[model samples]
Target: MNKEDVSFEIFPPDFVLEPYHVFRKNALANRNRTESQEVDHDMDILYQFWSHFLVRNFNAQMYNEFRSLALDDDFSTRNASTGLHRLIQFYGASLSRNSVMPDQVVRDLVDLIRDEATTRAEHVAFYLLRSAWRSGSLDPRNREKIDSVLDAHMTAELEK
Candidate 1:
């Protein structure tokens, strides 16, 4: 599909982060209390938006901008990190349901898990594995690599 076929326009980072901020605020307010259905609904909308964006831009340059947001240290706070992880998850899940993910995206996610020592890394790794599994895109060798890294991460966490 060409750029013209895409129905949605890519928004600036600030615009993209607006829903995330709203969801984060709701989550923070709901902590230690019963979860609000409204928060869940908001998150669902956010995920849908992200999923659509990923699917439409899977082959476009906008993917690089999205990936940059996911890996950006400026957006690495706890809530932002969680939002990034969910965005990646939605993207991967969409690819799994429709088409194969690009090799570079897989490699970048694996590298993120390998180099980053954060919960976001683990979450991304898990979603990547799920996406690969569902899409039948992961070969045995790549599966082994991801498994090894996840195993090491789990072992470290257990030791701690």
Candidate 2:
């Protein structure tokens, strides 16, 4: 091949190098970069992480964002193109099977039920209950009160 052709040819980096060496270099670079960036941009990085955490912690946000894409809505394809739909589906399935409910997540769920039920809380509660139900941890014997609250909240939402 001509030099230009050779230069333009795409080769998978991992295929050409010892995987460990490539991985070690990448890991070292990533660690150094993150450390330096964290020191210089602490608030910016923290805010970014916190925003991601909130979007994930608030089940209503999670469900609305995902369901909007999973359904045949106008932006479904565009949303799916962002890969969030798959991510949400995987996360939802994992939550359903693992019986893992973080303390913060539960607290947010409760807050939604008590404070935002008529407005934003309603949607969040719906998503939270669905996640809990999927995890098989939302059984009547264990979470009856919360379940009842969610049911009532959902009923209210539907009526609107």
Candidate 3:
């Protein structure tokens, strides 16, 4: 079969390629690049790429980074603290900011869980981070409160 026929066979019978239609109409669109008509197909493609990338990579990277930062004594003196604090503040100021607790809280919990799991010779960080990450979606307020409680507990422990 020809490439076009093969493609048609692969696609659902009712399927229509929207990008092909857009490409066909691009000459007309170029004549009228109005505010809404100005299509940034490149950005759309980039967004899709990153969306897939994050979906595929975020979990593994997040766990490893959290674990590494948690166990590393120098993390507090490094990017986990001040850099992350700035990120939280910037996101908090934006109206689009959905996060209620803070990234600092997340970083603190990562450190705390890492310490507990590593020093106690228990692989608790993965469990804690996984549960906390899940709770972030299910019960955000509870997640924040839990992090706060854990932070207090860790701080008190460190004070000794």
Overall local distance difference test of candidate 3:
0.39
Encode model 3's per-residue lDDT on 1-160: one tens digit a residue.
6655554776787865566336435523442342332323432332233323323344444434333322242134332232222222322222122434334445544555555555554434335445444544425563554456565555444334
**TM, every model:** 0.42, 0.27, 0.21
Give the best candidate by TM-score.
1
Q: In what order do the candidates fall by TM-score, top score first? A: 1, 2, 3
76 Cα displacement, candidate 2 (Å) = 26
Error of 3 at 79 (Å): 29
Point out where model 2 deviates above 4 Å: 1-95, 121-160
Scored against the true structure, residue 1 in model 3 reaches a CA lDDT of 62
lDDT-wise, the better of 2 and 3 is 2
Using TM-score as the measure, name the better of candidate 1 and candidate 3. Answer: 1
Off by over 4 Å in 1: 1-48, 77-79, 116-124, 127-160
Q: What's model 2's overall lDDT?
A: 0.41
Candidate 1 per-residue C-alpha lDDT over 42-118 given as tens digits, one digit per residue, 9 for 90 to 100: 43454445556666567445456455534552144223443455556654564455444566665665565555445
lDDT of each: 0.51, 0.41, 0.39
